[model samples]
Target: MIKLKAQDAGLSIAELTRRSVLLKPLPKRLSKITLATYRELVRIGSNINQLTRATNTAIKMGLRPPADPEQLEQLRNLLQQIGRELSQIETEITDDDDIESDGDSEDWE
Candidate 1:
């Protein structure tokens, strides 16, 4: 019998011990779409942070920051698009769970 070491299997000791009994597999890797969404989120976050810092600096200098209506609209549209994409992804995940549960029930019979 071949012994499987945690380190050899590229898993932590705790994860190996815990999962060994239950025999549950690890979660799947992030899909490309999910990764791209996260990257977009980070980019948007950085842009907002830069805007905030600029606004703060202007306030400290007693100068009013000029706002461009077009930029604001673009940010608003980007946010809305992200929200829609997240909702769609969430729906897909929920649907997958439902299908898995249905299949599990058939296995019991």
Candidate 2:
């Protein structure tokens, strides 16, 4: 459990042990839904990369892609939406972090 918590906080086991002795608060993990959304984003990004590579290859070969224009526009819109979603998720996580920090660090110790 201590190792897991330390990993989540990007700390070494030694650092985590030191924090524990000092009663320092640990960083919180994202909620399950947030993690799931990130996973879905990665999956979608992989698909987009495949599509982009195919499109680029076709262009380089002087081949006109049948669904090129419309598909590219859709991908652009999707990328914008993904950016918005990421920003929203970041804001939510930042807010949560701020809430945790409202308490003084000395309180934890």
Candidate models: Cα lDDT each: 0.58, 0.67
Q: Write the per-residue lDDT of candidate 1 for residues 1-109, one digit (tens) a residue.
A: 1133454345677876777767776434333456567788878867766776776677678888655545755775787788678756754553234432333222100
As a TM-score, model 2 comes out at 0.55
Lowest lDDT sum, 10 consecutive residues, model 1, at 100-109
lDDT of 1 at 80: 71
Off by over 4 Å in 2: 1-12, 20-25, 73-77, 90-109
Clashes of each: 0, 0
lDDT of candidate 2 over 1-109, digit per residue (tens): 6675577567898988888898887665554455666788778877777777777888888997544756866886887698688767765664334443433333221
Candidate 2: lDDT of 13? Answer: 86
